[model samples]
Target: MNFLVFVKQVPDTETKIQIAGDGKSIVEDGVNFIVSPYDEIAIEEALLQKEALGGEITVATMGPNRGEAALRTALAMGCDKAVHLEDDAFEGADSYATAKALAAVVKKLNPDLIFLGKQGVGTDNTQVGQMVAEMAGLGHIGMCVKLEIDGDKIRGEREIEGGRETIEVSLPAVVVAQKGLNEPRYPALRGIMQAKRKPIEKLTVADLGLSADEVGAAGSKTEFARLEMPPAREAGKKLEVEPEVAAKEIVAFLKNEAKAL
Candidate 1:
C-alpha cells in the first residue's frame, strides 16, 4: 500500500490577522506560519497507516516556497517523501482551483490511499478534499474519526449533525480527517536531522498539464469584494444587585438591547 497525505500551511492561529492594502489578502510580514492543525492530524494518520501496513508515505502541499517547511515537518515525523506543488500561478487559488491542481497530482501518483484534512483553518471552506475526490474519480469519506482497513476496503466512522455514521469504501479512495482522528506526534531530534537531508520534489502548473487560466486567481470561481476587521466587542456589564433583579435585568437586556429573544 502507498499513502499520500496533503498538508496545508496557514497563519498561526495565535497570530493577529491584518488586511492587506488591497483588502483581499492578509499582511504576511512578521506573521508566523504553521501546518494547519487539522492537516497535522492527517499526517499522523498516514504515518500510523504506514507503520501497520508496511509502505512509504509521501506528503504533499500546494503553496508558495514557504510551504516546503510544512513538508519538512511532515518528513521529520517519519514520512518517506515530500512534494511541493509551487508556482506563481497558484497564488490566490480558491478551493476549487486548488483541488484541480491537487487532483492532477493524485492522478499522476496513483496512490492506493489519500488523506487530507477535513478543512483548512483560515478559510474553513471544507470543500477541497471532496473536490479532489470528485476530480480524481475516487470515492471519498469525510470527517472520519475512526478508520479500519480491511482486505481492499476501509471502514470509517464519521461525525454527523448529532451522531456518528459508519461508511465502507474500497481502496484508492480519499479520506478527509476530522479532529479527534488521532493525536499528532511532534518531530523528534533524530527525525529532524534526517529530514534536513531528504530532498523535496517540486511540481508546477505546467508540469501538471494545467493551463494558467485553469488554476490560481484566473481559475477561481469566487472573489473577495472587501475585507475588514470585525467590530470590537463591548465590555460586559457586571450586576451587583439582588439575584432576582439581576435576572430581570438580564432578561431585559436580552430582549431589548441584545434582541436575541
Candidate 2:
C-alpha cells in the first residue's frame, strides 16, 4: 500500500500573533513556525499504518521555503519520502485553491490512501480535507479517530457533533484525522539519521503545470478584506458584602450580568 500524508506549517500557538497592516494576513515577525499539531497526529497515524501494513509513508506540503521544516520533521518521524510544493504565488489561497494544490500534489504521488489532519490551525476551516477529496474524486471520511484496515477497505471511528460514529469505506480514500488517533512518535536518532539520507522532491508552481490564476489569490473564490480583533473585555468591579448576601449577589450576577445561567 502507498500512503500519502498531507502536512502543513502553522504559527506555533504558543507565540504571540499580530495582524499585518493589510489586516487580512498575519505579521510574520517574531512568530515561531511548526507543523500543525493535528497534522502531526496524522503523520503519526500514517507511520503506524505503514509499520503494520508495510508501505512507504510519503508527505506533501505547500508553503514558502520555510515550509520544508515541516517536511523535515515528518522525515525525522519516519516518513520515507516527502514533496514540498512551494511558490510565492501560493500565498493567501482560499480553501478551494489550497485543496486544488494539494490534490495536484497527491496526483503526482499517486498513493492508494491519503491522510490529512482534521484541521490546520492556520485557517481552522476544516474545509480543505473534504475539498481535496472532492477535487480528487475520492472517498472521504472526516474527523476519524481510529482506523483499521480490512483488505482493500477501511473501518473507522469518527467524532460527530454530539457523539461518535463508525464508518466503512473502500480503498483509495481520503481521511481527515482528529487527535487520539495515535500518539505522535518523537524523532529518534536512527530516524533522524535515516531522514537525512531520504530524498525530498521539491516542486514549484511551474513544476505542477499550474498558473497563478489556478492557485493563488487569483484562483481563490473567497477574499479576506480585513480582519480585526474583537473588542477587549472590560474589567469587573469587586463586590463587598456578607457571605450569604455575597453568594446571592454572585448568583444574581451570574444570571444577569454574566448571563451564564
Candidate 3:
C-alpha cells in the first residue's frame, strides 16, 4: 500500500500575529512555524496505518522554500518520503487553486489512500481535501475520527451534527482527519537524524504541467482586500442579583447586546 498525507506549515497558534505593511497578509518575521496540529494527527494516522498494513507513507506540502521544513518534520515523524511543492507562482493560492495543484500531484502519485487535516490552522478553510478528492474523482470522508481498513474496503467513522456516521468506500479515497483520531508522535533522535539525509522531491507549477494562470493569485477565486486586527473584546459584565433576575438579565444581554439570540 502507498499512502499519501498532505501537511501544511502554519504560524504557531500561540504566536502573536501582526498584519504586514501591505495590509493584505500577516507578518512572517518572528513567527514560529510548525506543521499544523491537525495535519500532524493525519500524519500519525498514516504512520499507524502503514505500520499495520505494511506500506510506504509519503508526505507532501505546498508553500514557499520554508515549506520544506514542514515536509522534513513529517519525514522525521516516520513518513517514508517527502514532496515539496514550491514555486513563486504558488503564492497567494486560494483553496481551489491549491487543490488543483495538489490534485495534479495526486493523479501522478495515485496513492491507495490520502490523508489530510480537516482544516489548516491558518486558513481554516476545510476545503482542500474535498476539492482534491473531487478533482481527482475519488471518494472523500471528512471529520473522520475513526478509520478501518479491511481488504479492499475502507470504513470511516465521521462526526455528524450530534453523532457519528460510518461510511465505507473503496481504496484510493481521501480521509480528512479530525481531532481525537490519534495522538501524534514526536520524532525520535534517530528519525530526526535520518530525516536530515532524506531527499525531498521538489515540484513546481510547470513540473505539474499547470500554467501560471491556473494557480496562485491569478487562479484564486477570492482575493483579500485588506487585513486588520479584530476589535478588542469588551470586558465581561457581572451582575450581582437574584438568580431569576440574573437569568433574565443574561437573556436580555444575549438578545440586545450580544445579538446572539
- Model 2 accuracy (lDDT, Cα): 0.89
Q: How do the residues 238-261 of candidate 3 rate in per-residue lDDT, one tens digit apiece?
A: 779999999999999999999999
In candidate 1, the residue pairs with backbone N, CA or C atoms under 3 Å apart (3 or more residues apart, or in different chains) clash, namely none
* Candidate 1 residue-wise lDDT, 44-140, digit = tens: 9999998898998989999999999999999999999998999999989999999999999998899999999999899989999999999999998
**Preferred candidate (lDDT higher): 1 or 2:** 1
Using TM-score as the measure, the top candidate is: 1
- For TM-score, candidate 1 versus 3, the one ahead is 1
**Candidate 2: which stretches are off by over 4 Å?**
238-246, 258-261
Q: Tell me the alpha-carbon RMSD of every candidate.
A: 1.6, 1.9, 2.2
Q: Which pairs clash inside model 3?
A: none
TM-score of each: 0.94, 0.93, 0.93
Model 1 residue 196 CA deviation in Å: 0.8
Between candidates 1 and 2, the one scoring higher on TM-score is 1
